[model samples]
Target: MTNFLVSSFSLSAAPRNSVSRIQQELTIAQKQVATGRFADVGEALGVTVGRTISMRAEMSNIEKLKGANTSIAQRFDTMQAVLETAAGSGENLMSSIISNGSTDEGIATNRRLALANIGQLVGVLNSSYGSRYLFGGGKTDTVPMKSDIVNDYATSQASGTVDTAWQTFVTANAGGDPSLVTADQMKSFLDNEFAALFVTGNTDPALNTWDLHWSNASSSQTQARIGESDLITTSASANDDGFRNMMKSYAMLANLSGESLSDEARQVLTSRSVETLSTGLSQVTDLRSEIGIGQERISRANDGLKAQTFILKVAIGKEEEVDSYEAAIRVTNLTNNLEASYALTARISRLSILNYL
Candidate 1:
């Protein structure tokens, strides 16, 4: 019989080594597959996480912008309501003036009330949003009207008795043809004319001077218009449209006080009031309409932002989240690979020189 020498045996280590290497590779591949990221850990971990965080931040910003848009829309709606009230009050005042005329005490009372309403409107014009006034025309904090009382009438009215101090101005500048003055020249003339009228120690001592008193006894130095018509002649000339109309209206009211006005005169005054009120109302309506359009645009922009945020959220999820089915599948594959590796390692352990002997 051949000498049967049962030497100590061991399994070939190659199979065990191959199984361990395969298991390590499968672990790495499983991590990549489960995370739905690139297989290279050196590059994908930081880049993918940073990308997801950035996308989340972008989505948060879009949501915040949508909230801001909503707030602005609400503000616009409130402004529209206020403007509507103002327009309605204006219309009511105009109708009353047209129907009652100057003979009616109610008309005068209503006119006074309308003036008060205009004061209220001025306050609304100075309404603010975040420290910015709405109607200040870019000078947000500045009030447009001074509302101080000054002797506007006696100082501004052209005088025939005192050689018309403005005559010197005309002679010095326009050769006595006041109509030759342009709009800017007229504005400059009116500004200086008002200063001369109100300021003490005038260059022309012969010019007529007047002291101004307030409508209310409590308020000192308040210059009230003589009448609705005085608004025009109170200045050297009717220069500004708003100031001119205001003076003319006041002069008309003054002329009608305590006197019976002719129907024709009443009709003219009523027409003028309506025209002015209508023009102001049209401007207010146009502005409100523009705000409404802006509100709509803001709403649309918010919707777009929300949609974009949703898309970004989806993108972020795609970049970072593990797909459940895919991850489970990879885990199952890894488990099977691990079991095979253990079986191969066991078989290799069993294979030894003693078994061959």
Candidate 2:
């Protein structure tokens, strides 16, 4: 008789291997049901796994940009507040001059006001946000002005280039008594010598008062990256024309207030101060508008990033997330299959000559 023979070792090994395979499948299904995602993402996604990885990376980048944008927006807000306060101080100075007239008492009072405003301006420009000076441009760690503008003006008046220049102007014009100089002569000095000191591009040590004594701010502004390709200015410089001009106007009033000048000279000086202040106010307004534009651009960038994040999340979910209800059903089936496998393994283990007894 022809009979097929199978080894007892083969029978036992097949059943044991089947039980092991079923146990592994049950574990995977149980994990999927518990987590609502594929237990083996790379295995299930196969060659398409790269797409999910790319989407996840993009989402991470967008989140990082959004976080940075929050700080940029805050910096812009601080700058706006500072500029607004400076503008208000300018207005108050203008009002003080206009209402106080040109009498000796008025001049004294106005000098006090100008000095106070100078202090305020210096403090605002040196304003710091979390250890960084806001108006220092790219040199955020440095204080923009080493001292108050008044102190620098006083130093120049006492024993510096400004004092030397003033004496030279008086000598050349044969105008007796520096304090009693005529209006026309004072105008010429202001137009030629004093105004030159505050010009933004002037690098002459004898003329550029701002660079020599007043400011330590960098000309290069600070910037921030709010998006993948978007960059915007995030700081203002104390070395700008607006700030310099304002300081110059205040210096003229404060320095001349304590002097014994002719009525005509005082009138000319007051008129020039008013004109200079007006120009500085206009420039300060422009700076405020620039910060506003940056804020708007940051808002737009944040909106775009938020939208991109939403889209990427949807794509990632489709690739990695599993239906919980379906996974639960699979878990039940896998459990029953594992139990049947174990039963067959037990039956095979019992098949021996001793069972036949």
Candidate 3:
């Protein structure tokens, strides 16, 4: 009587539900086998899921830092190349000054050379990396130096403040001829007037010349974070004493080339230009060293980050990783269970009261 009361709906529904559940478990096991990780990490890890999340977050951060380090290393390399070019230009100018810059012919030749070097130096200082001006300090979006500064100075040499100052010196000394000007007088003009033109932050309109003509760089240097707590200077400024001194050397030569000078005055100019250029070149070398040091620190930081990345991966593996062998065995068991359930469902569906009789 109890067997006669069995319902057809209950017989089919039980095996149908069993097949559906086994299919779902098989799908999960197959996924775990393929990925070698938990199919439901949160479900499996429970409260320990937080540790897995934290480790994955740290891994993501390390990857981002590694990418940043790569970009910073490239920027440092570009800066090194530009500094090398600037140093070469300075050396060429120093050689010209030391060799034969005092004679009229030599002055003309050296003036042309200095002009060329000025263009080259300006081009390098105004150099860019991915739309950012490398020498602009924090003002990376702006051009660091005037591209036409050399040309502008050349065009205005006769009409600008430099000529005005020279005219005043001539009037004071009561001399119409530049050849009649003494070395000490030329020294005063060079040290006082010409030097003023290149000086930064002079309130006087005549002396505030560098800002007006040449440099647009910020006084602040560019800095970058290579690590969580490590910040380093990443760029050189066009307004640095090194760059300004270099410009001073080139400007003095180019502007003075047209004037007829006494041998003593020319000698004084050449000597001073040589000293300025040598100092500038030395400072350029120092800047290169600074960039090199930053590069070294980045290299060391990356090594440490890589080590941490490896450690974090191992730690995460302990919590989220699944054994592929075990997962494959589970998949096989689930597949067999699903097939048996499917057969049972088919048998239950074919059941009839007349067949049982």
Candidate 4:
């Protein structure tokens, strides 16, 4: 009597509604199994949403940091290759200078190599990567050293400022006979005439028309933060001590080509060239060491970031992802429940008042 008033519509609709709900749950479980994440991430994370979001943000930042480190690594590696060539050339120049540059036997050949070395140094200084000059300091678009300066520097041996100064000093002290010029006088000429060109930036209009290749670019070295609080220099400019010394050495080698090949001349040239080139070698070695340290630090930081990213990823997975094995089991149970509900609804719809009587 209590169920005598049950609506036939209700009897038919109840099982269908139940089956639909179970089918919906089954669909969500299937999605979770397929995608490895909860269908409703916000619902799954519940109170842990804050931690999951924070971890994901950190992971994103770590990826950006890795990208920056990769860029720095490429620059440093290219710089290392350049310095290797420059350092080798400087060392060889010292040895050649020590032997008086082979005493006119291979003078022409040595001159060619020396000139080529000048060009190579200028090329290296003007090296670039994607619009950024490796040695330009803050002037990324500018060539760090002018190749024309090499010619001017080499030609200075004959009639440039240093040559004029050399003539004046010799005329004043030794009646313009360079052979009669003392070692002291030669040293004085170098100190007074050429040292400024090496140690100080050339401001003479006739020397630098390009207005590039400043000698005090250390202050303009570019910096980047590979970490939250770590800032490091990423550029080595032409103003570096090694490049300055090497430039002077190369220039002196060129100048010597225009001088007398006598023992006295040789000794003076060798003395100056060897001393400066040796200093340059040492400086280049130190710079190499410094950069090596920087590269190692960057590498370690990069590894740390990757490890952190992995940890964050694992954390986020646990917080926002579904267990595929458990979801699969849930899918099976829900499918069976849906099938049973569908069959029960069909059977109930088939029932009639005569069968109950």
lDDT of 1: 0.50
TM match of model 3 to true structure: 0.87
Model 3 agreement with the true structure over 194-310: per-residue lDDT tens digits: 777777755575655676767888768777777778888877788888888888888778777568887888888888888888888888888888889999999999999999999
RMSD (Å) of each candidate, 1 decimal:
15.3, 4.1, 3.0, 4.2
Instruction: Compute each candidate's TM-score over C-alphas.
Output: 0.50, 0.81, 0.87, 0.82
lDDT per residue as tens, model 4, 158-227? 2254456566777898887767766676777777666755544445645641233333233377889888
Error of 1 at 224 (Å): 42
| CA lDDT, every model vs. true structure | 0.50, 0.82, 0.82, 0.73
| Top lDDT model | 2
- Clash count, candidate 3: 0
Superposition TM-score, candidate 1 onto the true structure: 0.50
Two-way lDDT contest, 1 vs 4, winner? 4
Native-vs-model 2 lDDT? Answer: 0.82
For lDDT, candidate 2 versus 4, the one ahead is 2
> Which residue runs of candidate 2 sit more than 4 Å off their true CA positions?
1-27, 33-35, 147-179, 203-207, 331-357
Q: lDDT per residue, candidate 1, 192-236, as tens digits?
A: 642343322234544423212111111111121222222111000
Give the higher-TM-score candidate: 2 or 4: 4
